[model samples]
Target: MAPSLVAVDQLTVDVITDNVSDTYASKPPFAVSELANIMQAGAQEISGTTLLVANLGYGLRLTTRQGSKEHVLLFDTGTEGAAFLRNCRNLALDLGTVEEVAITHGHWDHMGALEAAVGAIVARRGQGNVTVNVNPGMFNERGVLLQNGTIFPAARVPTPAQLEAWGARVSNDGDARLLLDGHFYYSGEIPRVTSFETGREDHLCRRDNSEEWRPDPYLMDERMLVVNVRDLGLIVFSACSHAGIVNVCTEVRRLFPDIPIHAVMAACISAA
Candidate 1:
């Protein structure tokens, strides 16, 4: 049987922390890209010192609406806490409105600001315990292997305890599930199914801080977020597709054969 559509009336994704943006370019349809951002922000002050900063990471603020009700979901936290918060403030994002957060993977570039982001959410909401989705496999120590057989460690991400201290209610599981009142679907551990798409092969990881390092090419812990729009079909958010963007889209299609993928966000080939 086909799964029922988790339909949403509207969806808007703000690229909170990406590697690039066309803010300075004279974008078509929207005259003066700078003014477009400023006008869209309303009363929020937009200035050179307070402009959004692009980082060598990926993050997004996804807002979905159905009639009067709205849901906000934070996908990934970017590479650095200062940059992530700075971008959020520049965009005038209300962290309290973020009902759920899905950390796409454990790589620092995607989750370095998890703690600070969760704390900001809690601070604005006047409480702790903001739910966050994660996979246990991503918590292991990871690194990249050099030609000399020595492994250079990757940036460390927050642990369950650290995230908890910052008011995050961690859900570290391996199964796929719905989020944001079923408006979004957080995928389970992705199954590598493509012939041409493998994974980042040089990435090495150890299950423990002092364990023997092994080839952790596939990054099995990474997950994707999917939202089915009213007319556009499925929109998938795959941050730093270490699993290959094609494989990610294929998996989404396999899960919801009826919902044609309309768009993909943060789909990138990770060299690190």
Candidate 2:
């Protein structure tokens, strides 16, 4: 049967179990069976709200209620191993059916399994079948050095050529063209309407031994996935929110002022 697109959620986070001395040394501890039970229980709690849970821990996969024949927008692929693949299999999800993989930044953890993930998708769909939309040169364009002198550049920033070679397309506008109808929309570059998010400093990227920090209004970190549900306002799924959550909410309000913010899930909190 042709797979119909459906919104579903599943648990993607995994409990680290292998090679940890602490976990391995415990009495009857690190039991895969026990851990699986606990994970299953936790998964049940959030299952109702999840559209499609991809294992961001390694790679990504998508599954829906109807069956495992749904498509997914993978954010990042985990490092090599059967861990990610096995997780998908356990969830009855197929990595070969990913519709898009959006790499939030150039961080190793985020894009580690990018090639593998793409290969899986290609194995299902013929060569040059899928499009991977990425922000063009976003990593090379900007960054910031924290007050503690720690530098944070744009992570996982892949060039257009690099993405194309992997059977994907790239865009810097942060707008991803939709392949399936009724998919969630992305709230592109957010507008800082409130004073709560202003005066953020940009990290310096040194090319020729010269260092400089400046005010970056663009704050390239401002991006989110917005889902406009019937009565639920806007549901936003965020990666590392370099731009404060408030800033992201404000931008959502600007574009969709009438919509209420139903929920927000993010990986990092902005120090700004």
Q: Each candidate's TM vs. the true structure?
A: 0.91, 0.62
Q: Write the per-residue lDDT of candidate 2 for residues 187-224, one digit (tens) a residue.
A: 44555555665534544432222555344544563456
- lDDT tens digits, residue span 1-272, model 1: 12644689999877778887667665546233533554566635656655777778888888999888788999998888898887777667788898788999889988988877888899887555478899899889999988888889987789988877777788989998888778889989888877777677788888777689898888999899999888889888888888888788778878899878887777476433
lDDT for each of the candidates?
0.81, 0.50
Q: By TM-score, who's the top model here? A: 1
Top candidate on lDDT is: 1
Q: For every candidate structure, what is the RMSD over all alpha carbons to the true structure, in angstroms? A: 2.6, 8.8
